[model samples]
Target: MKRVQAALQHFAQAVAAAMMAAMFLTFMLQIVVRYSARLEWLADRFPILNPSLYGWTLEFCLLLWIWLVFWGNAFVVRDRDHVTFDILFVTVRPAVRRWFIIISGISICTALVVSIEPTWAKFYILRLKKTATLSTIFGDWIRMRDIYSIYIFFLVAVALRYAWAVYRAVRFGVEEPVEAPAGQPTK
Candidate 1:
């Protein structure tokens, strides 16, 4: 299970990276085209007529941004690196801290599970709508639900991560995170 989770995390990270890169490229292309369009001489010389790839840039950047955010959340959860108001928790005894982790993790997992159905329904309804840029250009339009499905994946990954956290906290109690050397893996 750990291996599979790690593999999925890696895959999600790679996809998020690719999406970010593509978003950058498309945004740059929009900038170049917008500037080029300003110069009538250049516009005339170029084979392109409408130098407004703005729609495409906006659509894809937003699409990629949404995906990257949800996928990134899983990474944050995996590392237990989410925001902490540890002013109190940090001062507690080790036994108290373990209980805190377990309790919080269970709550998070429960919340995620409860959200799954409503989230799915909302995204499913989104499927009825087509993307303006991607669908229009591809001719074989993609549904909004397809783009929004990343949230579903995020919810599952996070729920699993938190569930694992709860299990570990229950089985081993509150333990400090192992701090490995810069280049070494934590045991």
Candidate 2:
């Protein structure tokens, strides 16, 4: 099970890395194409020097960025990597902290689960809307629904993560989060 989970984690990280690489390359291509249209030498040589020819790059970058943020948060980022104002949580003892974790987890999980249907409904409506530039490349087949679909995955993944956390807290309880002194950094 541990091995399987580790492999999954590596795969998720790889996916995120690939998304970032693609976004970076697309952005660079946009820049090169934009500037090439301005340079007389290059413009004279390349008939396809119109920056507008690659207008889809902007939309593609935005799409990848949305996916990267949600997907990375859902699978790649660990719980501890999240920023939290945990003054109340950290002040409490281990037993109280366990209850806090359980309660918070349940609340978050419930909220996300409840939102799934409404989110799906919104996405369904979005299917009618095609992107301005991307449609030129991918044809009318690509809609706003396809670009934003990663959000649903993010919602489900986070809800499941919280559900798992709640289960673990119930089974073995939670320990206090490690903290450094007032001035020292956490290791």
Give the number of the best model, judged by TM-score: 2
- Residue ranges of candidate 2 with Cα displaced over 4 Å: 180-187
RMSD of 1: 3.5
- Per-residue CA lDDT of candidate 2, range 1-187, in tens? 9999999999999999999999999999988897787787776678677665798999999999999999999999998778888899888898999999899999999999999999999899899999999987788899999999999999999999999999999999886577789976454
Models 1 onward score TM values of 0.83, 0.92
Top model by lDDT, which number? 2
Model 1 scores a TM of 0.83
The all-Cα superposition gives candidate 2 an RMSD in Å to the true structure of: 2.0
Off by over 4 Å in 1: 1-9, 52-54, 76-80, 177-187
Task: Specify the poorest-scoring 10-residue window by lDDT in model 2.
Answer: 43-52
Q: What does candidate 1's lDDT look like per residue over 83-117, in tens digits?
A: 55667876788899898988899999999999999
